[model samples]
Target: MTTPQLLMIEDDQRLAQMVVEYLAQSGFAVTHAGDGAGGMAALERQLPDLVILDLMLPDADGLELCRRIRALPGAAGKVPVLMLTAKGDPMDRIIGLELGADDYLPKPFEPRELLARIRAVLRRRGEGGLAGGAEPARGLRFGSLEIDRDARTVTVAGQAAELTSYQFDLLVAMAERAGRVLTRDQIMEAVRGRELEAFDRSIDVHMGRIRAAIEADPKNPKRILTVRGVGYVFAKQQD
Candidate 1:
């Protein structure tokens, strides 16, 4: 089996080197970037199997980087991402996860724990059996909104809606299980291959964005609805 290609984006030189060494030793083909620019550059040159991203980078923020990574075309869309940050705030973790990170690791972490997280992410993603391509054949329709699973495209009242790969994936996952209360953890598992961190409400943010694109009125959304103490549910269009 091929070693997993991993990109480590961290501004701290010592920590970056240590992570690179540890990951490499753990059977990952690792590349280290000291700044956001370099990290993005590395991504453009060749996409890795996974990315270990630091939240505070010199040139760009980690959340934006996660969005960019998920926006990449074709096979790159399915590559899992593990975010690293010193910030232990739940909000920060939620935002990172919302931006399409597969997992999050607080700073001053053990290499072993990070490795375990990475393994879990990979396993979850792999177990899904979701092959990269356009959308699948399954589709869910509600009023003007039609989600083509095979095409991986969404249409609002017949006009195609432009969505990032991550956004499209999130929509399809929720729509497929419409009406079922999917907790953030379950949604994370199905959509991004990970769980939400405490204070990480990024999922809510992304869902809001999705509502804006799909709902006639985001504030009074008719499609995606919140499930108190659980997660969110995609509502079927009312007759």
Candidate 2:
């Protein structure tokens, strides 16, 4: 079996070398790039199975690079990207997701956790020999929201709704299993490709952002309903 390839784009020399070594030990073939231009050059030649991109690149902005990657012909529907950022602000996280990143990880993180996240993203996209469980066939449509699995696009009232790759994945996970209660861990596993850490409060923040985009009243949140101490449920709409 061919080993999965990863592109590591970061300006931090020590961190980049450490991540490359760690990811190599984790069984992935990693190519390292020091700046955004180098990263883009490498991508233009051959896109990796996944990308580990640092937001604070020297040559160009990481978010802009992500957008460029998304715009690339073969990348629009393939090659998931995991953005790495040092900032932990909720808005920044949301913005990264909104910009088409598959997932975002705050820096000063454990290497093992990073590997887990990489595997999770690849698994969710049906790579790494992990078959996805059953999903809805006809696709899910609720009010102005339409999730087309085949196209991998979400449309709001016939117009494409701008969603980060992670948000889109989260929405699909809930929509397919509407009315089913999903725990925070389950949701994180499904969307971010990582289990929730103890005391991690970011999942709720992401969920709230998702609701604000999809629900008629984010304050009330009819679409994604909270289940008290458990998790959340995607309420099935009846016509």
Each candidate structure's count of clashing pairs: 12, 1
Compose the digit string of candidate 2's lDDT tens values, residues 1-239.
78999999999999988999888888999999999889889999998889889988878988899899888767763678898999988687767766677777898999988888888777766522112655456567887788777666766668665554456667787776699998887776655455534323556766766776676678988778999999999989732
For each candidate, what TM-score against the reference? 0.71, 0.71
Per-residue error (Å), model 2, residue 82: 2.2
Provide C-alpha RMSD values for all models, in order. Answer: 4.7, 4.2
Clashing pairs in 2: 97-164
Question: After superposition, which runs of candidate 1 have C-alpha atoms over 4 Å from their true positions?
Answer: 63-79, 98-100, 127-170, 184-203
What digit string (tens of lDDT, one per residue) describes model 1 on residues 3-113? 888889899999988878888898988898998889888988988778889999988988988887877664333577889999989889777756667567898999888
- Show where candidate 2 strays beyond 4 Å: 71-78, 86-95, 127-138, 143-145, 156-159, 180-186, 189-192, 196-201, 204-233
Candidate 1 CA-lDDT value: 0.74
Give the Cα lDDT of each candidate: 0.74, 0.76
